[model samples]
Target chain A: MNTDWKNIDAASLNNLTLGEAEKLFGLEPNFTEEELKKVRNALSRQYHPDLNPDSGNIMSKINAVYDILKNEIKNRRNAEQNNANGGATDTSSTSSDSTREEPEAENINDNAGATDNSTSENTADEPEVENLNDNAGATDNSASENTADEPEVENLNDNAGATDNSTSENAADEPEVENLNDNAGTTDNSTSENTADEPEAENLNDNAGAANNEPRNENSNITWEDVNRIGVENLTLDDARRLFNLEEDFTENDLIDAYNRLDRIYNPMNFPIGSEEAEKNRATMNSIYGVYTILRRNLINRQNVQESPTREDTTNQSTQVSMNPTNEKADNSRNDNGDENSQNIPSADNEKNDGQTDRPKDAPTHNEKPALSTGPTVGDQIASNDTTPDPEPIPVIKSIPAKIMDHRKQILIIIGIIALAIAISQAINLTLVAQMARNGNLWHLTAGVAEKAALHAKNINLTSKLIALKSSYDSLSGVWTIAGQKLLTGNLQAILRGISAGSGILGLSCLTAGLIKKKSAAYKEYKKNIRQLIRDFNDLSYDEAINQINSLRENINNSNELSDREKQLLLNQLKKAEKLNRQFEDIDQGEELEGGMSL
Target chain B: MMVDSIITLANNKNYLLLMESSILDDSYFLGVLLDDNMEPTVDYVVLKKVEKDGVVCAQQINNLNTLTQLLEEYGSEYAENYN
Candidate 1:
């Protein structure tokens, strides 16, 4: 059915549901983005203002409904994709868990085979014991024939009975061993118990393995009860390593691998939802993940300490350090053991060691003069001991001139708008002036009427002549006033037009300057050379820094690398640096400043 | 006949005849003055047939407020069609 475009108002149209919107467009529900676009285009063409003059409201409603349907379709597709991704992750975890179970099953089978062999050996010893008993009985009969043989027969019977007792004890031990193996297998196979015990066993094994310097693959002797007594919070770094099934001296990569393996096996998604196994797996996963996070944070902090540079060693290398404000803010934040850093590591177990691990444990205190107190800043390596040469700097620059030129298009558009507004204002003013000139004495009708009444009371001939003379004078005066007003308006318009033109020219010049700077080979080479010089400033002596600054000034003046404007900008920057250097000298002469300066 | 004469007069004067209605045997006409550009301007006026001396002529109703009210009533009625 077709909707009557003329009858539907915007309010009622907006309240239409998805099905109603589809009916409006003559399409089925759950249309694709492409199909919606095609239908929308057809409807747009049918009701467009150019084709149908009275269709503005209708066309707008059509577009609004089109957008609603398009967004709905897009959201549905996004939700489907997200669900697919979640399903894929669950599948991968389940597959990995199954693979892990295969090895455990093999281990259980091997244990069962050992128990069976032991049972077979006990059975073999039974027959031998029986034979010995028979032989002792025969000896006992012979001893009955002679009183001297009775003592020997008694000793033989006792020996044979002792052998039978020993064999029976061995047989009883074999069943107990088999029962223990069976219990271990049951613990591994039982979903709820295995989920709870395995992680704990692994964590304890991790600690035991570390203490014994054992390989990761060694069988765990520690029980889940021992781990429960120690508790997850009190677990040590070795426990975390064991939880990941890692050796004592594992690298970051090894830790990552172990974490991935445990994560897959213990992932709750691998189990049925809301089940006991899932809940237990979730708890175990959280424990493992928390331990892993703490260990990794400690490892990273230790690495940062070793890699940091020493300020004392670099003292002879450079006296002046260029500390940008951005770098200082970064260093202050990095060194500050505040709430923000604590929030970054969000583990309940980690909270216990917050004071110890929040900052680098090995990092020197404030009283001790550390080489480099914080992480390195971008583009400024103040105390780096790296011997390799710095790479070539990128030619990208963000100078003030370049930034202004970036808005050249917007500037041009603004100038054009201003010009158009001025022209329209001038046109309106001139139209008013022309209208005023045409109306003339019509504006002063009341005054004219009053003058005519007085003229009629006086001599008729003289009054008419005087009235004619007055009318001519009034007309001339009006013309002069209109001309003066037009002149004033014209001058104002010219001044505004001149201002607009000047701004347009300024914008164009900025655009040209930006383009020249970008394309200039000399500018590129200058930037590359200056970057290297700036990087070396932290390593140069005070006098050397001064010499370098002077040489840079001379280079700007002598070289054809930069335009006059660029040279001026560079000179201004150098002046700031020179002033800073003088301030440093004053500080050296015992004049302390409250805060430091940054470039 | 009065309506036909008013229409002819309005055409000759270049006035926009906005609305007309008949009640009993009498007809009422509403129109607005047009400027030199032929666009509507100034107040609207009511027109009716009246005999002045011996000749029948279309006379303008001079009550500007009443004419304005009538124009507003007509404007509201047709506003939905265009907008």
Candidate 2:
């Protein structure tokens, strides 16, 4: 009756069931496909934008509604085909029934069976063809305006004829088709009623708390973002419940209902086998099951807790039983006098038994026992006196020092890298010196020496002869001539030997120095002493700090293995420590003198 | 003393003072000068040589006093003690 369907937004339209949507077209929820076509034809003709150009975007809304309803019809037919083909067990088939609730799930078979009866009734729909023709003939005058819908109506007629032909083939087959379509068309109206009663029945059960958790948004169009927002692999029970749109006051029934609806919505079969949409749906499906299982387990645990009395309650009951050693005898007497005392004397024991049984078992949070106790409320006192005294919190360093401490390891690693680089470079230099020796490339040095010797001779006032010698020496190559071949060879040999010896000595010295630095006890002792001295200085114990500094200085001076450079570094540390100690001593003396006098 | 020995050797002209080049890099020469087909014909040998700016620049290494001063200049006054 509310045909202003143009006012509905896409989101609300997506949420609409086939029954609600069919009502927008002014048709009953139980309308056949042929009747649905008739309704569409009538609605479109009345609201065609070309005919009613002033209706704004009414045509778009009509088209959107048409497309969505068409999809639902297509889905229903697919589900029926699947059922006929014995593919009803297909998990995807369940997903196609997304709008159906859990209570309707049981009626799927009943509805399918009832639809057989409805389809047989649809055979009577042939008489209604004359009315459809009349409506179609009325629209012929506005042929140009109705051209878009004409072909579609013809196709519907063809489909209806095909259905009629199929109906004539076999009554048994007709029922299956009828059941699927009938359930598809009238599912909302009939199933919704069936489900309403079922939910009430479920609520009446002791696990009524679970029934309250039924998801309110039953036919939501879940998207990829929604699936991602409810993360799949790490899907929590709460997130799963939220995904199902369940409320806080939930029961096992609510969880099952929510799971079924969501499972149908996220059926992987709805999307392409391996498409992004399918993957999203699969994740959602897995998450739904995951959440369902957790909630089911929690529900079971809760029910178990409710069914079994609390540990304290059991203990108290046992004590009551022990105190009343005649409980068995009393029970036997009560049974014997069941008709007499049932109306006369209301026993306190009977009242207590009734109170315990009637006490709320819905949640563990309810402190019903404290209220039942006639004495001082010990439970309330214990709860009121609950105090968890926490330990003192550590001081959080919020300054540059904290940052530096964090990077201390990185700083040490960098320093070690630099030291390694320097050592590698030094070793490389020593290798190059050895290589120079091995190559016997001492001719350059020989030429240099000769030139210097010539220059020295010149400096001693030997003049022209010395100058001539210097010029000859400076220009000399390492090549031998006939006159001094043996002499040049001998000189080259000696130079090579001397260079090899010098390089070997230099390499040995370097290696020994590295080994000594690492293994030297004197160096180690000096480093330890210096570090201790610095600590003492920081402590502000002037006398002790001064004594440590002196001791460190003595250690460094006595250290035979430390090089001059190492000794200098230690001495610098010593000077700083001595200065700090002196300053502290002055402060100490001033404090002492002040203590001796008035404040 | 080394300068006098070099002068006497040059004056006699029995020994030829020869060098490979007027330039020295990290590579250097330090010994008695010998001609091609080298023979150590002289009675004494030089222990040091100095080259600068791609030339046979000075006779300073020929003087022991100047050599010791150079070592001290580079902060090795205790050079013999280290050796």
Candidate 3:
């Protein structure tokens, strides 16, 4: 027997019946609870997957059989208790004789008789007698009808006790009895008294039906009401995946495919409208759609996280903020403009804009180029004119020609400083270029020497020396080739050196010209005017400062004494002053607004 | 009986076709066959509807490799436009 057990395969183990399971454990079918437990523990130790790696199938089978036996024992005990409680008068003899009847059959008879007697006599004393008689009659009839299987039932009864025998027989006969009862209850209207007497029996019959029907009951238990109660927001990722019959690693396409298949299967249009099946399918479809929506959102969010792992927190915050109506509008406007500043800025005013009113009319749109004429000139005006008024008298604005002639020396001096800086930088660059050229020449010489030495070694049959020299030649040859290419392509470094030296010489000449210009009479007059203008603007209010700067700029632009380049330089300074004044105004306004809001 | 037919059809590289849709209609399906000993083997088959005996029948495509090849060739385009 032990050798036979060892020879049994997984398939045989899985196929074990209750009788076979008992034999596998080396026990009789009528084994006591303690005996069953002892055998199970011993078998589990022998077949545990941890100790025996290939014992998974055997362990699972053992566990499965144990669960079935446990449930059977529990049901048998419950049945005996119910008999003792409900049919106490007749149970002493009937329990031993009718132990081969199923617990469900007994339960139905007990309930039915109790209901019948309560209806007829308004008393429950005779309920147990009636119940016992009904069950006995049914079992006797079934046993007679299934005479061919009587020996098997008798064998079970003799060896495994009456409860085990009943279980085996009931499993085979319960469905047939359930169907018979259903037909009798429904179509046998002629037996009105019987119907009236045993109304609860039909329900018990249904409850006792096969395990295969349990899944349908389970599926039907989920209703639209339940789905609504557990809203999409509350559904977990696992629940959604289970609904779609999908795995964790499923992609967006996989989710879509699952949804499509479910949609096709539960399509309400496939059923007749307003029918129960149609209503059920519609509810199922809605539930599926809810699941699909949740899973799709999860898939999208997962992909987004994977694509930008570094930006997850920022993305989540942005998504949360974007949910607000105000922020959503602001985001849409910013997105439409495609401006980096619009995206980067997180101001309340931007949120309030809603596609209009926020952006300046003259500001560039996403596609349009900045209007260059207005940009610098308007900036110059804003910087100069948007300042506070001064208590002191301001200097009168001069004509462009007068302003230029006055500051001519200062301008020349600025030009000389710029030239000197350029000359110094160019001299440094020229030195670096000369060093690079010398390095290239040295590399070229080394390449030629290595090539010749490789040839000399090869001619003398010095193999190792030749190989080493060849390697050096190869490396130096690459550098030499690059140098030769550069030389062929116009000796770029020499050209660079020449250009640097020429620039330095030109810078010296400019410095010399500027120094001569700086000693002129016009230079002294313009220097005083410029210094006075700066001192007056320093004490002025924002408006006054802006006005004075704009007037100065007009003078610079209109003056014939000033060249375009000189005029441009003066206007740029004005633009900077104007920007500074505007920024000061904005800061002051912001502070006032914040103070007001706080109050 | 169904298990016997499946095993026979599988060995012969052929499969049964149910000549009417009765709940099981899909691009892919899994069928479980329980032997006399109640040991179960699961097989995945692709379902294709075809006209057999002048009636629409869901024919089980038993060859997994063939199904995979076909899916590889056309699955993406079909999935994208299925809606």
Alpha-carbon RMSD to native, per candidate? 44.5, 44.7, 41.2
Candidate 1 residue-wise lDDT, A283-335, digit = tens: 34444444554354334333445453333222211111111111233223323
| TM-scores for the candidates | 0.18, 0.18, 0.18
Clashes of 2: 18
- List where candidate 2 sits over 4 angstroms from the true fold: A1-13, A17-19, A23-236, A307-599, B1-83
Using lDDT, rank the candidates from best to worst: 1, 3, 2
Candidate with the larger lDDT of 1 and 2: 1
Highest lDDT against the true fold, candidate? 1
The residue ranges of model 3 lying beyond 4 angstroms of the native Cα positions read A1-21, A79-599, B1-83
Least well predicted 10-residue stretch by lDDT in candidate 3 chain B:
B16-25
Docking class of 2: incorrect
DockQ of 2: 0.00
